[model samples]
Target: MSLELESASVEQTQEIAQQIARLVEPGDVILLNGDLGAGKTHFTQGLAAGLETPTVPTSPTFNIMFVYEGGRLPLYHFDLYRLEDADELEDIDYYGTIEGDGVSVVEWADKFEDAQPDECLAITIRILPDQTRVLSLEPYGGHFEDIVAAIA
Candidate 1:
């Protein structure tokens, strides 16, 4: 199943992220696709809130990945925008991170679709001319379908 939502402000986007976060579990992967300044990181911050993590999530562009513990489940935030190829994912141990006991959120995930697992939640954020953001959630497996249903 899929879901399309509109966010009039950053807070709304975060709210949507939090809603989704509640449905997240270990071994789950969230693929985020959006342009620069599309609020991917903001959405992540909300995920951290839903997970109840002590540390807020920030853009992992420079660091590649940031692990947040002490939440309902750990959050492995990854940004692949700076990477030129999916092969670089290995350097960061991408597979290991996602397969571990945490929920992985990958920004610029469209850039490395081939590297993504078959079952995952794919979210695309599009910025409208009026500045509102449109978030489209596409679920690739049954687990994700349930998440979408709950969000709906």
Candidate 2:
């Protein structure tokens, strides 16, 4: 099942993400899907704050991935927009990191189906006509299902 929520502003989007952050644990994978300028980074920023990460997070568009430590758990932020194909995931050790002791958040994850885990929390942010955002949260496994229930 999917839970739908609305955000009237960028701050609201981040606030909603912070709510999810509280329930996250090590080895959690969050797949983020959204269009350009759809507030994906903003949501991630809030997640980092909720996790108590020392530094703020920026989009890893050019770098592809950014690893932030010194928080409740490590944050492995990834952007797959630059990748031409799913084969490049291996070059970045994508699978290894996501399965590591950290919470993995992948932006533009829909770009490559192979990168998606069988069990994860997948979120899609849609831009509404009024410039607001509609976020749909879907859980793919039992753990994620519990999270969605708590956040819903």
Candidate 3:
């Protein structure tokens, strides 16, 4: 599908994420990009909240990956900031999480190029002045396209 972009505040960003989450099924991957403090985690919080797992979802930076299971589908939150290489994924079961029965939201996904799964939603958030954001969503596959369309 064509890439979808929008301007949003932190709350609007979360609401958009929630709307998108309504269409996601299990085993979905999200590839996110933005500079520091681009509201990536805020979008994830909206996604988890939309999934009915309304809670404070952390960065998972130190933990590498945080799995939240109290939603309609499980949520696998991965932060790759401290990750040196994608090769270390095997040690932490990256493939397992991406191919498993859950929704995975990955922050700083630029570190993994060819390693990213085929079925993934790519997002880029640009921080604007005055606490606003420019967010773009590029769905990479048919499944993700459908989800994007639904949310759009």
Note the Cα lDDT for every prediction shown: 0.93, 0.92, 0.86
- TM-score versus the correct structure, for each prediction: 0.98, 0.97, 0.94
Kindly list the per-residue Cα lDDT of model 1 for residues 2-102, writing each as its tens digit.
99999999899999999988899999999999999999999999999999999988899999999999999999999999999878988999999999999
Model 1, residue 82: distance off in Å is 0.8
Backbone atom clashes (below 3 Å) for every candidate: 0, 0, 1
Winner on TM-score (2 vs 3): 2
Cα lDDT for residue 50, candidate 3: 93
Summarize candidate 2's per-residue lDDT along 20-122 as a digit string, tens digits: 8899988999999999999889989989988999989999999999999999999999999999988899999999999999999999999997769999999
User: Which residue pairs does candidate 1 place in steric collision?
Assistant: none
What's the lDDT for residue 87 in model 2?
Answer: 82
Q: What does the lDDT read for residue 65 in candidate 2?
A: 98
lDDT of 3 by residue, 23-121 (tens): 888889998899989999999999999999856688898999998988899999999889897788888898888888999999998888877887789
Q: Once superposed on the true structure, which residue ranges of model 1 sit more than 4 Å away at CA?
A: none
Pitting candidate 1 against candidate 2, the one with the higher lDDT is 1
Between candidates 1 and 3, which one is better according to lDDT?
Answer: 1
| lDDT score at residue 5, model 2, on the 0-100 scale | 95
